[model samples]
Target: MTAYILLEIRRTLRDTTFLVFGTGMPVLMYLLFTNLGGGGDHDEWKAYSMVGMAAYGALASAMAIGTGIASDKSLGWLQQLRITPLAPGRAVTGRAISGSVTVLPTILAVLLAGALGNGVRMAAWQWIALVLLLWAGALPFTLLGIGNGYRLTPQATGVVNVACLMGLAIVGGLWFPITEFPQWLRSIGEFTPAYGFAELGRSVVAEHAPAAGAPAVLAGWLLLFGGYAVFSYRRSARTA
Candidate 1:
């Protein structure tokens, strides 16, 4: 398992697109938002935007990992692995483990950049909790990405990636606060995985409050997406 995970991590690191999107984009967005002065001068708003961007970065990483897995399947990687001692569960676990390991450094770099560049602050415990929450938050979306990758063609995977990113950005309060959005939008955002993640992030960095309902929402998403991944894996295995 450890060897498989290390190989996966190395593969991810060698991917140019993954490094660019997972690391570069978040840092670019953070700098843009902070420099543009659009988030307002209020410390709270700055903190909110900083944490939101970090959470968004995490989501992007999860999506990329998931889609990459799908691409791998399309390219016969999973098929080759299935003939080995590595079972489906262990394969997926390695993917998830390696994805998180690769993406996490970028997430932390974003947070640190926010702190040093934008003056966002959090206690040590809050920072730890935020990291935990971000990882937890990525799991469901990663599973969803895996399911989508397994089920969709390469071109379709690109379309779904765009749609998923836009949906999460708009509904998860990355573009704007849920409080300012329309009632219906807010209602939808409240139930979304991104919203739960954003709220948890904000709670830690901005509000200094506990993440109340985020764990449950994230867990529900994990279960839902995990089921889809399992189903897709079974169907694909049979077809293969």
Candidate 2:
């Protein structure tokens, strides 16, 4: 399991597309958005934007595991794994762990851009908390990715992942403040995992506990996605 987890992390790092888009894009977006707001006058907005982009970046990278898994299945790598000693469920879980691990660089890249580029400052503890919470919050998306990988063809998974990432970003207010949305839209966005995930980090920046609903929303999604991933993997196992 440890070996498999490390392999997945290394593979994710090696993917040029992931490097450019998953990790690099967030930093680029942060810089662009902050510059548009004009200089250092909006430190608060910069911090808020930093959290939003970091969350989006982490979410995108975590869900890329689905495409990787679908590609592996297409190439018969999963079949080769059957002869190994690793349990099927354990292997999938390791994939999720690895996906979460890969989210760190994306989070760091955006945070570094915020700190150096725009002077978005926080205490040392807040910096640590922000990274840890954002990384942990990506777990549900990683599980969702696992389910998609097992249930869809590589082509379909790729398309669905792109849509999912964009939809979540738009609906969950990762691209803009939820307060800017109409009341009805804000109501819907508040329930999304992406919204809750970003809020967890923002709460750190604000130096307050996250709202009670944030953890509850995330926990519910985590359980739902975990079940979906397990069922999809088992169904695929039987079919294979």
Measured by TM-score, the strongest candidate is 2
Best by lDDT: 2
lDDT of 2 by residue, 1-240 (tens): 999989988987788776677788878877987797575677788898888889888998888879888888777777677568888778778889988867899999999998998888889999999999999999999899879998889989988988988888788887778999999999999999888988898899889999999999999999898888878876665544
Model 2: lDDT equals 0.86
Candidate 1's error at 118, in angstroms? Answer: 2.0
Task: Tell me the spans in candidate 1 whose CA falls farther than 4 Å from its real position.
Answer: 207-211, 238-240
Looking at candidate 1, what is the lDDT of residue 142?
A: 78
Evaluate all candidate structures by whole-model CA lDDT and list the values in order. 0.76, 0.86
- Candidate 1's displacement at residue 209, Å, is 4.3
| TM-score of candidate 2 relative to the true fold | 0.90
Every model's TM-score: 0.89, 0.90
**How many backbone clashes can be found in candidate 2?**
0
**lDDT score, candidate 1:** 0.76
